[model samples]
Target: MKYVALFLIFLAAPALAQDDPAVAARAAAKALEQASEQLDDADSARDRVKALTTTVRAYEDGLSAMREGLRRVSLREMDLRADLAEREAEISDLLGALMTIGNSEAPVLALHPSGPTGTARAGMLLADVTPALATRATALKEDLKEVSDLRQLQQEAEQRLTEGLQGVQLARTELSQAIDSRTDLPRRFIEDPVRTAILIAGTDTLNDFAAGLGEITQDEEPGSLPAISDRKGYLELPVPGKILRGAGEEDAAGVERPGIVVGTRPRALVTTPTAATIRYVGPLLDYGLVTILEPQADLLFVLAGLDQVYGRIGQVLPAGSPVGLMGGEMPAADEGLSQSGEGGGAQWTETLYMEVREGDDPVDPLTWFSTDKG
Candidate 1:
């Protein structure tokens, strides 16, 4: 009967040992799955900051879940440790009881129960309990071994969760930078003279022209030009006289002219257009202080023989802004005109030259205009 009881206790030990480690591992895996789902949802919607934040939160939650699992594992280990300790103490007590039960003096003492041998009676009970004590001690030692294995598992899970949190932080930083890059440029161009005519030309031709201008691409993409119904295209000066000269011309060469010589600036020549970006504020050659109105419609219109240059690079002006003072020293306005004749005069002519390059090939500006009479 004693041996049978000991055999049953040993049978129960293996079952208890199998349950704890399996339960902890399952709980940790479930927490990780939930965290992964949240990260995926944030990424799909294009909100990088939100996605990174979600990942961080998920990692935090995972850490909490892992810690909880560790806590449960630790508790389970403690329970096993306590059980082992209790069983050890119980085995010692049982051995004393079993020895007393199996003692040879036990049967002889039964006839003299009134004698002063109570301690001796207990000795026989300890002898009968001895085999049960040995079986319990071995079972409890196996339980202690399980607690050690569980402690190692908890440590490994903690280390992985720490690494996951760091990865989340790095992702958040990059997403913020990407968002700033997309929104940094101006929402609209503010009354820019150089870009306004380009916009009027329509989308396709403007894009083609802008592609050829390697330096201009750095600023902004050229937009479509607005359509004008009249097709007056650009206004031309009706009166023939020396108006302005461009930079490189036969007469203006080395003469320190402000603008390219097309015609000499007549003393009473009216202000037709404004200077664009004032590249050179001071007077140059036969031309007075010349300011190159940043080109419009692929035409670099020079306002030569100017007493003043009124605008800066980003400044916008209405038509006929005063650009320069009239003087004979300035280049003639009609110096380069094909129909007009060039003559020796302090009065210079200014003719508009259109260099319409598809890429590098210059096309005649005369063909692009609506009216040839200008």
Candidate 2:
């Protein structure tokens, strides 16, 4: 559905080009406002939870759209800069030729000519060159104006990118706080201190940790949580963005993984796709700040690359419950590759690494989530 909406938007570009940017920004702001209103108007805890989810997702979508716009503007700025350079060179050459003509010995020729016919010929040549010089001057003036406009556009694009990034950060902070406030759900799984300690002590690899976690029995009643098997091909994405990598694909390190990587806005909300028990939440190996969730007795989902985690080990959370958030701003680099950012920068890219397993066997998550790439 998200892809369809975007495709429709693209198709209407010719009609929307004049006002699309302002309209899109306004629409995003309006969506956020409406979500907030809904949250306030909600009469029940369930309604409020839904409202909060909408609010977070709206903010994520808004930020994503703004970033995309800024990227397009950046590309346009690069093209404009190239054009400006070429135009400047042309203007410089034209000016040089004009200067050479202006400093010519035509005046001396007028005073001392070989004959009347020679003088008439020189006069005709001067008349012909005058219009050409005027034309070149006019072109030079237009090129100067164009260069100035390009500079202004570039400056505007940079300003928009900075503002968009700041807005995303603020929205993310608000979403995090809202998620933290919802603590009304009953605990379905109690933390096993002994098991947790043993798992932490004995496990050195992800597989080993997962195996240890699988051994721990859940205190929650069976059939209490929703069955993920029943919702195949209709699950919402844990985050609101496009999928970057499909299952069985090789990552930057050239290791083939049984999961999908999603490219999301910086500090985007990361939530549970279904009700699940938290098995682990911490940094592990190259996967920073990972969160492991078990949707069923045998099914496990792994989410990695979080800047901050929310739930604790053995806690049962409802579907769409906040797990954590994507990392904050990072240095600008190739977004396609998964590289951790050094510090918060004006523009950054984040990748959410996700994996699914059923009874220790890896499964393709693309077959589970809705096909909508919104």
Candidate 3:
């Protein structure tokens, strides 16, 4: 819906994505690449990563600010347009009044002379004079000037609105691309052997990362939970669906695993509460069309079983909004393929998997999400 403030109007219903951590990471990395491209100085890998992360965060902020500015500009333009319309109407009314005064049917004098015409000579003389004509001419000129000025103002406002709207749209597009880039960036930098080593480090690392994110504990029993602040709430499913799997399972019912899972009817929109940065938004093993949201550094939100992702990374969004709809689930055999970072572009026909990580460890998402009877 368009936001209406008094006479102003602004479009506020554009889709927002930016809820995945992978997207954020990619953006951060790309920003560094751009900077390095321009600079002659050599920087360490760690330094580049740090610089890129900061730049990505700045761009995310820029996207949010641009969206807001566009909204305001649109509203202003609407008001200006309305004003122009009123001015035009006023000019028309003035012209009508002048026409009425100049019409020949209405004689000016009430007194009728005893002539063949039954009209006073003085009255006839005055009606024929140009005094009334001069007055009407002056009024017309003034009204025309007013109309012209209003039109000029309207045009300027429209131009501003156009530019602002374009900026906002461009920022959105950039963020989306940045997210896609970031989700794949890690794969380029970290080879399979390194990633496998990272994965094998232990679930404790995953748990610690998840703990930092403040996601629901896998085992919230005594001595099992970690210390972390609660989020506003877990990312709510945009619509009804079923929870398919938790993160980091080697096998499910005699099948290999890749990412976690969530199953839904075809084309059901997925969403999270509030806006968040995207951690990863792409295809993964078993988790077809996956997206990961990092509400904060400590919390990671993963979404799978999407037909398409609506939002981009580094963009803010509201919870329970549509991230994407459900596609086919991943097959058990292909589940582990995601870990290998090889298989992609496969159509959905298997189970869905989802994960929530703080940093590296995968935490049980079931504790936070409402029960799925399916």
Cα-based lDDT at residue 186, candidate 1 = 30
lDDT scores in order: 0.42, 0.64, 0.42
Best-to-worst order by TM-score is 2, 3, 1
Query: What stretches of model 3 exceed 4 Å from their correct place?
Result: 1-228, 231-235, 246-260, 328-351, 372-374
Q: Candidate 3 on 203-291: residue-level lDDT in tens?
A: 34333323432222122222211333463334354344454554455564765433456554333335664455544455554446767
Stretches of candidate 1 off by over 4 Å are 1-26, 29-47, 91-142, 171-374
Q: Please, what's the RMSD in Å of model 1?
A: 32.0
| Tens digit of per-residue lDDT, candidate 2, span 198-297 | 7777777667778777455557454545666888878888887677778888878899888888876677778898888887888776788999988877
lDDT of 1 by residue, 149-249 (tens): 77676566555545444444444344444334433223212334455335334334323433433332224336422322243345543222433433333
lDDT of 2: 0.64
Candidate 2 Cα deviation (angstroms), residue 282: 2.5
Best by TM-score: 2
